[model samples]
Target: MEKEIDFEKHLKNAIQEERKLQVSFFDLVSKFEKKISNFDFENNSILISDYFYSGNGQKNIMKSLISENKVNKENCREYSTKEGNLKYDFKGVYFFLLDNKPFYVGISKGVIGRICQHLKGKNHNTSSLAYKLGLLRYEYLNNKKHLGKRKELNFVTEVEPVKQFLQKQKIAWISIDNDEELYLFEIYCSMKFKTILNSFETH
Candidate 1:
């Protein structure tokens, strides 16, 4: 016998884990979406890295520049838009790939909340257009709005239309990080690969 393993128990655990990951991934994508849409960063022009760092920090900034600036912005969320102790406005970049075909845009907001908006919609998040398009699912349990989000949106639009860029970029890694500053820094590596992967695929 094959040790009469408890396959049923294993199956249930697997299913639970899968569901958990699904929710978590959805949450991550949802945050990225919110950042891009909320700030309209699909139009980013300047890709300045290390603007916020100093001295030795510049090294980390350079390392993070790869995937982090494909989509860059000053601010990407609002304050006092929701109801709660919410009070944090972040400035950072959203990443997109342009391997001759733009796929999707993502980000790692230096603060919080905005990314969820893009994946989820504005003035009506429970039913944003992106949701209708069958993109990302709901991320945070509660919704929020903050200052600088509108300004960030303007900054994003000033760059270039992301929808139009779809033909240029192949894929993108979008996200917004609030847990650890280092996590936000790591997204740049993901960005580097997005471009690198596209190069390999195109050839």
Candidate 2:
């Protein structure tokens, strides 16, 4: 047989492909939780598949969100965890509903920072709703979306149908973020959209 495949190399390459988003996270979550009981994923990354799979989610999320048109796998970009560093990256909007409203678009560079800033009204770009909520920054993540732990940064950016799918499927919120920033991103996205949604619901 040929030499063993280089998993890390494959992951680095996968980071740039939307197909990575198609992983069966439910199975992974159950497996991860079984391995580490009481482990919270919503606030973490879903890139726990050894290491190789981690690489692919990053670039793909970015490419998916930013690209208006679906990116061709042939034209995707390759990246690595060592090189394409992302400490605080959440550069896309999450669309959703609260009480049957439509349209809630917002973006962030630092999911945690942005949410805090929004609550404090520090950033002008933040959704106005975040300010009125009077919530503080979150260091401890309670819970997030379905694939909370596994979500990579580029998913929000690269995957086009995510928000639409969420909206269509009537999910409370759909989000995207970095390797370690998914929870914060989910919080920010929900906060942003919550206002738009709740406001309409009350009015």
Strongest candidate by lDDT: 1
Q: Evaluate model 1: give its TM-score.
A: 0.23
lDDT of 1 by residue, 1-203 (tens): 34346777777788888332323544554454345344433344332221321132323433354347543333334445445444344444334334322233333333223333432223334222233222211122224322333234232232222223222232233333344432433353345334332121241
lDDT of each residue in 1-203, candidate 2, tens digit only: 13336776677788977654433555434443243233222322222122212233444443543453322233333333344654433433333333344244334443323333323232323434332221111112323323323223223232322222332222112233333344334444345335443332342
Model 1 per-residue lDDT at 151: 31
* lDDT for residue 33 in candidate 1, whole number 0-100: 38
Model 2 TM-score, 2 decimals: 0.21
Point out the worst 10-residue segment of candidate 1 by lDDT.
132-141
For candidate 2, what's the RMSD?
Answer: 19.9
RMSD of each: 19.8, 19.9
Off by over 4 Å in 2: 1-89, 95-97, 100-103, 122-203
lDDT value, residue 70 of candidate 1: 44
